[model samples]
Structures are given as C-alpha cells and as structure tokens.
Target chain A: MQATESVIYNRAGQRVVSPEYLLFEAPRTKHFMTGSEAVKEAVRRASVDASVSYPITPQSEAAHLIGELWVEGYVGVYFRGESEFGVMSEIAGCAMAGARTITTTSGPGTLRAFENFPMWAGTRIPVQLVLMARGVNSPLSIQPDNLEVGFLLDTGCMIWYAENAQDLFDMILAGFVVAEQPDVHVPVITVVDGFFVSHTREAIMLPPDDIALPPYNPYRAPMPVIDAEVPPGRFLRDPFVMKSNYISYATHASWQWEVRSAIERSRPYAKRYLKGLIEEFGDPSAELVFVACGTAAAQAKEAVRLLEDEGIKARVVKLKTIRPFPVEELKGAVKNAKYIFVPEFNVVGWLEREVRRYLYGHSDAEVIGSPRVAGGMTMPAEVIVQEVLKLTGKEVKHVL
Target chain B: MMRKRVNIRMPALGGQGAVTAAHIIATAADYEGYYAVSNPFFGAEKRMAPAESYARIGLEPIFDRGEVVYPDVIMVFHPQVITMGKSYTMPFYSGIKRKGLIIINTEEDLLTDEDKERLESLDVKVLNFPATKLAIDIAGTELSTNMAMIGALFGAIGCVGLDAIEEGIKSRFLKKFVASGGTASLDSALERKFKKKLELIEKNLNTAKGAYDLAQRWAGEQGLEPFLPPPPKKVTV
Candidate 1:
C-alpha cells in the first residue's frame, strides 16, 4: 500500500481499539503553563543531558527552564552562552559526544544559528533546538511570527511548528524521534509561537513516564584510528598527492547524496508515528480538513470541532512533523476533502511560496493560505471556522 | 432531541475581564454537573476597540471551541460595541437560536426605540440592566459589570443556580484576586456586585405566572396572538 493509505488503514485500526487499551496515554493534567514550560517537559522527557543557549525574548524562558532543570540535577550538563554562534558550537560538540543537546533562541538568534545548522545537518549530528519565532523586522513591533522558519526551509534541518501548548509538548517529544532516526541523522529545530506558545497558558495532556523509549541509532562516522607503532611510519607526501587525498571530490558527492537520501528515508517513519499519535487522540475523517502547525493547529482543531458541532463535516490534520514535510501523507489525508485551509503565522514570502508551488503540481485540492498579520495575538477559533466555512461554501451564522 | 446550546459572549477587549466572565459561566455549568467549555475569542484589537470572549454550555461536552455563532444569550460588556454592530453584532445575531436572549449592560432607558424594536422584531428576549451603575454602587467603580451580567444570566437561565455561580466565582476568581491584590480586584468586584441582578431575575421568574395570566387575558380580549418574525438573514462568511 502507499504510505498514505497505510496511515489511513492504521488510523482506522486504532479507532477500532478503545481508549482503555492504548499504552502510554498522555494524562489529562490541568495546569496553567506557558508554552515554554510544556517544551521544557519534552526536553526532560527526552532525557536531554546538556543545553547551550543565549537569552532572547520568548525563547529565553525555555533556556531558563533548562537551567533550572540542570541545577536540580535533571540533566548532566548545561551551558549559558554569550551568543548564538557559541551555543550551536557547544550543542554540536555535546551531541558529537553522545549527549542529547539543545539550544533555544528567537528572531536574530535564529538567523545567527541558521548559518551553522546546515553544517550540523551535513555532518549528521542530532542536536535539537527550539526556535521561538518572532516577526522579522516588520512594521509592527515584536510578537509571535514564523518568518525565520520559512527562511531555513532548504537548510536540511528537520523543522516543525507548535500550534499550541499541547502541540509544543508533542512536537518536542516527536522531535527526538525524528532527529535520532538512523536513516535521518539530521538536526531538528522545533519552531513555536513566540508570544502565543511561549507566553500563553493552557491545559495540556502529558504522556505517561513508563512508555518505552523509541529505539535510538547513533550516527556513525569513520574516525581515524592511529596505533603508535603503525602511525610512526609515514611516506613523505608530494603536494599533489596530499591535495587529492585530503580533498576527495568523490567523498563530498557521496556524503551530499547521503544527506538528501536520509531526509527522504525519514518519511515513512514520520507517517507511522503521526498516525499512531492521532489514533490515540481522535478520529480524523471529515469533509473539510484544516492543515496547520504549531499553536495555530490547536486553534484550528477547536475551530473544526465547533464547525462539526454546527452540523458541518470538518476535521483538522495537524502537521506535527513538518521537517520531513510529510507531504505525501498529508496529500493522502486531505485528498478526498472539498477544501483545505493552511493558516500560517508568517507571511508566505518564500517558504509557503515554495510549499504552494510543490503542492500545486501534486494535488488538485484548492489550498487557501490565511496569513495572519498581527503579532502572535490569538486567532479566535471563530475566525478560523468562518474562513473555513466560507472556503467550503457552507452556511455560517453571524453573531450580532 | 438535541438540547439547545446556549452561547454567552463577553465583549472582546483587553482588561475587560471578558475571559474571566466566560470562565465563570463554564465553571458554573460544570458545577451544575453539565458538560461545558469556555473559550476566549481573541483578535488584534486596540484597547478600546471591541473584542469578544465566549462560553459554550450544554449537557454534552462542547466539541466546538470557536466563537459562539448562534448564542442563546449574547452579553455585551461595552456599550460602544453595539455601534460596531456592523462588524461584531451582525455575525452574532445571524447565529442566534430561536427565542434567544440579548443582554446589554446598560440602563433600559438608554436604548433607542429603533434598537429595541429591531431586536424585539427578531423574537429576541432583550434585557437591559444597568450593570455598570450597579457595579459603581457596590464597588465604587464601574468595573464589575461582567460579574453582574453573569449574575443576571444565572437568574435568567436557572439551569445553573446562584450558589453554584458564587462558588465558581469564589473558587475561580476571588481567591486568586485576593492573592494578586489589585490585579484581581476588578474581577472580584464584578462577581460580587452582579448578585443584585441575579436577585432581580429570581423575582421576575417568581412573578412570571401572574404576568403570563394577565398577558393571556389581554391577548384573548384583543383577539390577537403574537406574530413570529422572519428568519434572520443568512451569513455566508
């Protein structure tokens, strides 16, 4: 079966199972927690031993929380850095040493780190970082924004956005799985709403502790081994021989293909994991499907349920795994639907422009991109439903 | 039969305690052992511009977390919001269930004849309580209208009782307000001052039978029955 069909069948099978039979369900824990606190829980759950960070608005709390964890002995190492460059360097080093590492930043910090993220991807490091998003020098003052994530789309880093507090938790949990996948040994950056997810408080359901950890496969690199006796003898090298051997053009080409193939190989694993997670939560078959990530997905889900209650057949397909771009699976899930609404926290400058380009050639569905202009002020669920209803040509009631 | 879903909308604005009002209503319904969910409607609005928060209360767990379209009860905290009727109120009225109620936190005399007639024509039960005045009288400020409005709603619906609302408010707001000092005082004051409106609603319900008898007799003598208004205009967006 096609990967998408496999996902649908798996979801159907999961629906056949009762909630009582699911293992490792997230507990319905009610607490007033900011998005950063929830992300902190994911880092804790992932057993991150070290975090390197520089303080920035919105994302600063995430680093602070990690610091608290380190002080409390939750992790083995923590580093407060002076700049984004330093943080990423430390993260790469720690991850190379087999420690799960993370870094947190927003806006300018995110831009600074982007310079090195591709290098980490090229080197097959599994460093995880949180990119709390903010507006990119827009006319409006600082607030929640997603411009940076869009800019880094082709950087080979696995990227996803959190729609709300719950999504933040789920993405953090899922990020580890994506980052450490054997075939996709690439870095991951989980983007969350700067003001919405980073500052706001909402109830969340936390997965239980006893859930078995997903299998981990460490990245394999060929390290040069030297023995004292064998290494002592060396032939005097000619300049041409040294250059050809040191800069093997073939090695670079092979490694580049491996990086590309690794990302492609991660698709099936992502689909399986997302399908399992959704089945454990709610059913996803409906007439209209709303696609969003990060905190926007939370609002979209609520909007879908509201529309459904009003006798409109609607549901939400939250893209928890955005990095591998779960395109095939998403296309399959939304293929039969009449309309798809993609609400984005950022302007569709280049990133969404690319997604639209890709989606256009693949699917015939009419995809509407609703770009939110204001800073991360919460988009009322009502507004989202109304937009979806309009797209689907459904009758909507007005509140006067 | 599907039970009627009542939506209680708090006008959207910052520092207006709109979210607090929505929470109190939801908690009150839950206290009454009814399945309820309260969601705050947020948008980018200036400090004085209208914004809305909403509560969805029913016997079933609320599946919709969006804005209440056809609210059985629509509550407006700011009087100016009524003028923004073209934008906010239009959407609200389009979804109002039959025999729904519209509650405005202003004195009855403040409504123009046109405003009252238009709402009454829709078969909407309109109640204009001087909640701001009541709040000022109780707390020496005009900030407690949301609470007073909630009190009036409890009296109006009776699905959730005043005691349950009080407990909901005390447990949800007062304790927090006290600890937060000035931060929570406005919310506490609103809840406390709205008790009078609840009392008025109870009194009205108690005397409803006599009023119903008198109305019936007058209708019989006049040889007329009330006419139903045309259905509300459908909104596409």
Candidate 2:
C-alpha cells in the first residue's frame, strides 16, 4: 500500500472496511504481547488523524509507541503536549477541527485534565481518551489502583472498563466506532487498570494490519464540522458567552441532558460492537454471583472456577460498559442470583455502590462488597475465595 | 497424577531479569498449547530493589493476575532474595505448595536449619546451583542468568521441550519485545556484549542448555514427577 497526501493505506494494500467487518469478519492471528503493545497494534489500524501525549507511568510507553506509529506513517499527526491539561485541550482542538483524535492519561493526570472531559461531551466532540487507571496522589503511587475512575463517573464521557489485554485491544477499536456514531457523538473513556493490563503479557488475537476500520467521516457528525471545508454552527461558533436569561438557563439544562442522552443512545451500538455490554461465564444456574469489571472481573472469573471445584455454584457478570450502565442486562443476569459479591481494586467500592443503587428495588439479592484491595494491592483469587466462604458461612478450605 | 495448573513465583532484585524469565516461561508454555499469563509485581521497580514476577500455566484458561501469592514453584534468581531477606514475602518460601519445588541461584545453600525443617514439613524440595556462574561459564556474561533460571524451571517441570524454549527465546530477542524499561535496557546491554544479534541468541541458548542438563539430571535423580500434564497437542504455528 502506498501513502497519498491525505489518505494512508496499510502495507498489505487492503481497503479500509466497515467497523463490523473489521472487528468480526476479518480473520485474526494470535500474538503474545502486553497491553501497551496491543494499544499500538490497535491504533495502527484505527486511521487516527492526530494524537497528543504527555508522560506518565504505565501509559508513557504506549504513548511513545503511538508516536512511533506516527513516524511509521500509520498516524497522520502526532506531538508531545506540555502537560495533561494542555494535552487534553490540544486533542479537543484536533477533534473540533474535524480530525479523529485520541490521548491517554493516568491517575493524577486524569484529575489534572479533568475539566476538558465535560467540555468534550458538551461540545459533542467524539475524541477517545484511553484512561489507564492508577492511584490518586497525596500519597503518590504509580501502581494500578482504579480509584480515579470513580471521579470520572459523572464526566459524561462514555466509560468502558477492559478486563485484560485482549479486551483492551478490542474495546479501543470498538470505542471509536461507538463514540463517533451520529446519535452518540460524545467522548469515550476506555478505562483499564494500569500496570495489571498495561504491563502484563498474554495471548491476544488481532486482525490483520492490512485491514482497518474506515476513516472518520466528519460530514456524518450531528454537528457541523469546524474545518475550512464546511461552515461551523452559528450557536457553536462562540459557546462560552452567557446571557442570564430563561432561554440560556433552559438551553444549558436541556443540553446537559442531551449530552447524557447521547451516552444512553450508544447502548445498541456498544452492545453490538462489544458483543455485549456484560459478559457472563460459569454455571448459568448458579445462585452465587460476582459483579465486577476490569481486573476485578478477571479475578472473579478465577474465583468462580475455584468455587466450582469445591462443588459450590457461582458465576461472574463482567460489566463492559460503566456509563449507559447496562441496567436491564444486569437485572436479567442477576435474576437468579441470591448472593452477589462485588470484588474491586479500590477502597471506595464504587462498583458495589453502582450495583446496589441499580438493584435497589429490582432484586432481593444481598449485595456484598468483599476483598477490596487498595493502594495497588493484589487481590488474588484465593482472597476472593476466602471472602466467598466467609460470607456464605461455608468452611474456608486450604485450597492453595 | 498430573497437576492441571502450575503457578510459579519468581522473587529477585530489580534488573535481575525475573520479569523477562516470567515472560519467556509463559510464552514457552503458550507455544506448547497451554493457557498462560505472566506479570511483574506492581511497584516502583529500581535496580537492586526487591522485584518479583509471576507466571501461571494451565490446561484451562488462566484469568488470575498480579503477584502470585501461592505458587507451585518458586525460582529465586538471586542469593540476596534469601540471605538479605530482599523479598516481598517474609519467609521467601511463604506459600509453596506441598511437594512444590524451589530453585535457588546460589553456589551455597542459604536456607537455615529451621527454614529447611519448615520446607521439609511441607515436602518442598530446594535445588541450589550457581546459575550466574553457569551463565558466565557458558554465555560468558552474567546477563544471561535469566536464561539459566528459565532452563532450570522447564527442566524440573519436565513439560515444555527445548525446541519450544528456543522458539520462546527467539520470539523475545528477534522481535520487538517490551517487558519494562529496565528489561529493555538490559537487553541492549546484552546485544552490545555479544556484538551480533544471532551470536547473542546463541550464547543465551548455550547458557540455558548448560543449566537445563544439570537440572534435568538432578530432577531425574530425585524422582521429581512431571509438574504438569502433557500440554494439549502442540499447535505448530
């Protein structure tokens, strides 16, 4: 494949296909690598227009790899930003100028760039932020602690938690497809636990590099493109100016609702592209269940297996999307469950609260948050087993 | 009876290539058609600091991640991990399973009498050898110490063949591999020492082969059974 002035073709000379064909129909070969490498491979086929990066642990290597892609001609524009705040604004500018934009950040960086997220949603720019979650500062830790994700829950960006390296690869590609939809033109935040997913090596199947998802079409956006090819929206030309009138107040209120509604509108697309908003595994008829996401869900899967070995029935309801929370699908999955355990890597039990709030009157199952490992502690499968046995009044076996 | 899953914990000082060893072991297991996962300890890793990594190999899909709290095998890549108590766990052999194996890279036995008695109670066997010495003797550099450790791991397990190990080593060195910042630097240092890429791989392979022969002979004499069942039919890729 040759590179034209504007369009870039992969080395195999294959034309870009639809997202569905690229994700499902295309044959994939297995590769053993880390999630950072997975990010590079995914962006290699994403047809990304521009990327701005800042330095942070567990995410800097991936950001550097993307810069390498830029040098390799897979990405159109790339540069290092002054800071996370500046980087977020720079990517927002890229998106506003009708360029497909992506960036990454970790714990403190996420908070430092916090203001741009809501603005990204309000302006309806479909930029994707791959948030490698880590511990917030004040004690200063660079390990994988997802307490930062709790702060982004209300940021209006569509949130999706990836379980492992394979999930990270697929979700990133699928995230762009879902976020760029006309009805769902909101920013997407693909969250993965730092270090655990970013540094761990595992096997993942990837589609051929020759094939890629079709390029971003700014014309399909619900809002007008801000580039020279098209005139910008009249009201959007200058959005910061405010008039203290009832119309302004009402417009502000309704637009916030609409931004959230756009996230809700992404359900069908996310469900279809991600295969499901929630993945189920283990005994289908089990009464004991685990509701988790990210590495917690991976640990829960292993716990399910260990629980099964002891003749106890259990299952895992792994949540793929946090925003536009799959309430109905979750309700359907936990209908038969009597004891629901939520395993998490943070002290806040944010997922447990979400499960409880959503299931307040829908189900009678007792929601219990167990084995919360904070400050980047490892929540091994054995810890989950002990939690399960202790909660269920079963004798804890020395299985290890 | 053959075990279905084997979790190996490696504790060593930073820059000792424990993380690389973990990656190669899992990659070799994957080549032999087993599900495997490997990861380093989540911390600020520095040179000479207590660094650890874990690998899980099983017939079924392995989902557990992070540090291996419980291990069927423990490979101590440095004498300091035992003598200086430069380890995350207090006893260094804290969670070894019954009849598990511990391979220590030291010329002398570092276990105290009480420690040996505790290990004996758990029926765990300790294999001590100067792995760094073997690396210097065969590879002419101590940087290949990880290669020797990997060899001993597969030697005692008696499952992954030498050809698969070779494939794992080739994929790691010949391809654009990224384990961490320190490991990448160490890799370049090895390349500079060998002067050629193929020669570097050849030296590392020779170091591993030397350690493999010694460990295999010792394992056979000790009647150590296969740590894992024969991996599902090898998929030639």
Candidate 3:
C-alpha cells in the first residue's frame, strides 16, 4: 500500500475536510511547493493570533510567507522582533493574552532564544515553535543539522520532527492541538531540517482553506486580563519568605514539578493528536531496524528499499513525535530486531543517544548510531546500505 | 506487484540551472499525475561549485527523500561536472546503477574510449546530446538550455509525455509573466533577456521542442525502446 499523505480520512479513504474556508483557494489538495511554503500555508490555515519572529536562514522564508499572509489580512497578530530573545518574549506575552502565537528559528537564533525556552513552560504558555534544525552558532554555515534541537531537549518543551513538507504541514496542526490541551499546557517544537526540507520542492496535499485547522483554543482564560479583571498568579512570597515557613518553600517548588508533570501528561495527547510517535515500514523481524528522525528517517527508508533488493532485509522505525520521548513506541517497533542503526547530521548524534536511552529494554538489540551524515553532506541511501552490510558481517568492499 | 520507481540523478555546476532542470522534469512528471519528488544537494558555496539535484518518479506516494544514490538514469548538466567534480569531492559514477542510461548535455561524449568500452560491456546506454548548442541556435541565448535538457529528458525517457513537459514549461514560466500581467511584464523580461514577454516564452518553447526532437531522433537511431506501462493483470477475487 502507498504511504498516504492525508492525516484525517473517512471510511471511503477520502480526506475528511473540515468546514472552515469553504471560500479560500490557497490549500489546493496537492500543490508543488517547498517545505517553507507548506509551513506558510499551514500557518495561514492555523489562523494564529500572533507570530513575533526574528528572521534567520532556511526558516526566514516561512516567517516571511506567514508575514505576507498576515499583512494581507488572512492571519491575525504579526510582529518583527529585533532578536530571537525578543521573539520568544513576545510569544510569552501574546500567549498569556490567550493568543495562538507561533514562531520559527534556526542555528544561532535558537541560541539567542535559549533563556526563554524554559520560561514558556514556567508560565504554562503553549506556543508552537518550529526549529528548522541547524548547527547552533559559530563558523556560521547555513546548512541543515539537528545540533540546535539537541540543546532544546532539556528545555522543558515537547518536541516533534517532520520527514517532509507534507509531514511539516500535519505536525504544526497536531502540535497546537497537544500543546493547547487543558491538562498539558506546554509549548511544542515542530522541527524540520534546514534547506533539506525548507528549500526542497514537492507536492503537499494541504487541507482546503475551508477544512484548514481550527484556531488554537487556550486551556483557560489567560492570566491578568485587565478587560475581564482576571488576576495573574501571585508571586507574593519571596525566597526569603521561604526561610519563614517550609510550606511556602514547598508551594514555590511545586511550580517546577507542575511543569515537568504537565509535559509527562502530554504523552497520550501527543499519540492522539500526532498519531503514533513512529511510522514503521519493512520487516520487524529483520536482523536490523533503521531508527531515525527528521530528514535522516526519509533517507533510511530509501536505504532499506535498496538493501531489500540485495537480499538483506531491514525495518525502518521513523521517530515522528519526538517527546515526551516516545520510548514505548520505539521500543515496541524495534522489539524483534537485533540492531538499530541511526544516522544523524549532527556531530553529537543526539538522535542515537536518545534511542540508546530508550532501547535499554531490548538488551539483545544493540544501538549502532553515529553522526553518519553531518555538516552539509546529504545522507544517501548508499551510505546507509553500506552500514547495514557491515553489520551482517558481509564484505563491505563492494556489495552495497 | 508494484511498478518500478525511476530515480534520476543530475549533476551540474553552480549557475548552470541544474537544480531548475531537475525541478522541471519532476514537475512535468507530477503534472502528468505521477508522484514526483525533487531536491537539490549543494554545499555552502553559491557559484562556480559542482552541485547535484535528484528526482524520484513513481505511481505511488514516494516516501524516499535525499539524493538518488542508486540512479536509474544519470543526466550530467555539463561535461565539466565530470571534470571539475563536486564541492564535497566525490566521483560522479559513485552511485550509478549498472545497465542504466546516462545522458550528458554536451556536443561530444566526455567518456574516453576505454570508459565507453567499459560502460558498454556493463550494458549501460550512454548518449551525448548537444543540448546547449541547440539552445543557442534556437533561443539565441544559452540560458534556456535547461529547458532544452528537460525536452531531451522527456524525449529520451518517454516515461512522461512530451506534451506534459511542454505544458509544464509554459505554466512554470508563465507564473511570473501572468502574475505581473502578461506583456506589461515585458519590462523585466526585456531587462533580463532583451526580449518581449511572448517572445521569451516562444523562444524557450521552440528551444525545448528542438532539443526534444534531436534526443528523440538519437533514441530512435539507437533502437532504444520507450518506457511503456505494464498491462493490467486479471483479478481472481
């Protein structure tokens, strides 16, 4: 069966269109566009309340597209911030006003926004941020890599990866849904590989304008709405007051615990909203399973196909929804496999590290991962097929 | 029981419009109602660097992404791509499938006699089409040679209809022309090419058709059979 693009379909296998933009024509079922263009279209359909952003390569096109839509009055709030730090700050304020704000950044921009990453969870604000993955900072090459994503892993936010432009369109909608839930009010990071996905053009079947995603509905009335007289959460007790009473210390400590637990509770919501954390193909009982996320996942799928013709069977378990880690889903998919081969484009190999952390249950299935495709090197199916041949104790000289 | 998916890899130098040529082919196939995925793989340098773009055309939704390593067809945009090589420094023939077709856009074949004999022994079909020469002859400027290459690809592959490619070329170029209001768009067209709006379109179309005819004639002379869809099998139920 063909891998389908429609996320929501009916019994007849036809896409179930939502009754929104019955008049708009932008989301024509299948339009050949770049991933950046698709994200722009998705954001227009999302009807965001605000998008305060600092321009950066790979991601700037998306931000610009959304800005154009906003300027033409198809979208809601839009702003140009001086820096990534200011952009994140705007997101926090707009989100507090119950605005469905969104933004995107890459490479050095991610570093600029580092301080505000944890603050999104601290304030329980659910902002949808797209990290078009890039190597964070110095040497200043504008190529695709996931090093920036590695830094944000511990920043108290839910993360997801998109394999292509179509997935980029779908993930944004799903991300907002999970982030806005009453029980899970943490922000979501929907990542796409810079240049690889952003610049590449392909056909993406977006929901028709009328059937576009519904606007984000915040969990409750936002704090400190002067119009409604709703009060913001009090910060009356200082840390010095904690010296006066242990109970006060516990109350302040609960804030940190609440954010962590909130993200943990978002796991089921992620599975529900974003479908399974993985999209698996090939044989589960094969000697090896190619585990990957983002652009590498797409490359792995192609490699698996090449290997199949050579009488070497393999499975592909693509990590889609990246956090709350998706350990169980990956564990289940790679259960019968003896090895997991992960290829990433960052020197850190964070994707492989994350896999090893979760693949502990399957003691027999060893995780073999490396920064196989790093820098500006686009990972080819030949490289992956070569890796699989090495594992089977076959001659690596020329077979693959 | 799935139809074969075709992977085509094209390598070109910077500023050669190689990436655009790849897009045209993929877009033409897509316009013909097939699923086509195209992407360009380039390094940090903007110009004068060797680059490669790829395309995967199939009847099904193609989940595959990145460069087409195991290419069914290899189209070299310039003979220099073989001579100059890539920025990351990899050989051109590193991932080409055996017994596949190689179409290079040059007047004379770049392959040495030994390499030609070696490739022939492997059943690989290698052809040299004077794409840029035809473009300069038909379109006055060599800039639209990419269009000529697309025409040659359609005539050579025959997987996608030549009519679809012609239509694809028109729609892609006409996007800006139509968007800015037809002949009133002549300012930029004239500024860039010293040609009127309609004249620019006419030249590109003629150049593409000219290349297509030459490539089709070569294919016919070589006794190469055009790709045809398989007949539907009877269902047992």
Largest TM-score belongs to which candidate?
2
Order of the predicted models by TM-score, top scorer first: 2, 3, 1
**How do these models rank on DockQ, best leading?**
2, 3, 1
Minimal lDDT window, size 10, model 3 chain A: A17-26
Candidate 3 backbone collisions, by pair: A20-A210, A21-A210
- Residue-level lDDT tens digits of model 3 in A109-173: 99988899888876777899998887655677777878888888878788889999988988887
Chain A (alone) TM-scores for all candidate structures? 0.78, 0.95, 0.87
Model 2 bad stretches (over 4 Å): A1-14, A232-238, A244-246, B176-195, B234-236
Docking class of 2: medium
TM-score of each: 0.62, 0.95, 0.84
For model 2, how does the per-residue alpha-carbon lDDT over B57-129 read when each residue is reduced to its tens digit? 9988788888888899999999999889999998999989889999999999888999999999989989997
lDDT of 2 by residue, A282-359 (tens): 999999999999999999998888888778999999999999899999999999999999999898999999999999
Q: Model 3: runs farther than 4 Å from truth? A: A1-28, A218-229, A232-252, A394-400, B1-3, B44-49, B82-91, B109-118, B174-199, B227-237
Q: Candidate 2 at B39: error in angstroms?
A: 1.1
Q: TM-score of candidate 2 restricted to chain B?
A: 0.91
lDDT for A215 (candidate 3) = 53
DockQ for every model comes to 0.06, 0.59, 0.37
**A86-185 in candidate 1: lDDT tens per residue?**
8887787777666667788888777776678877777677777888888666564456667788887777787766666666777666666666776676
What are the clash counts of all predictions, listed in order? 23, 0, 2
- Give the higher-TM-score candidate: 1 or 2: 2
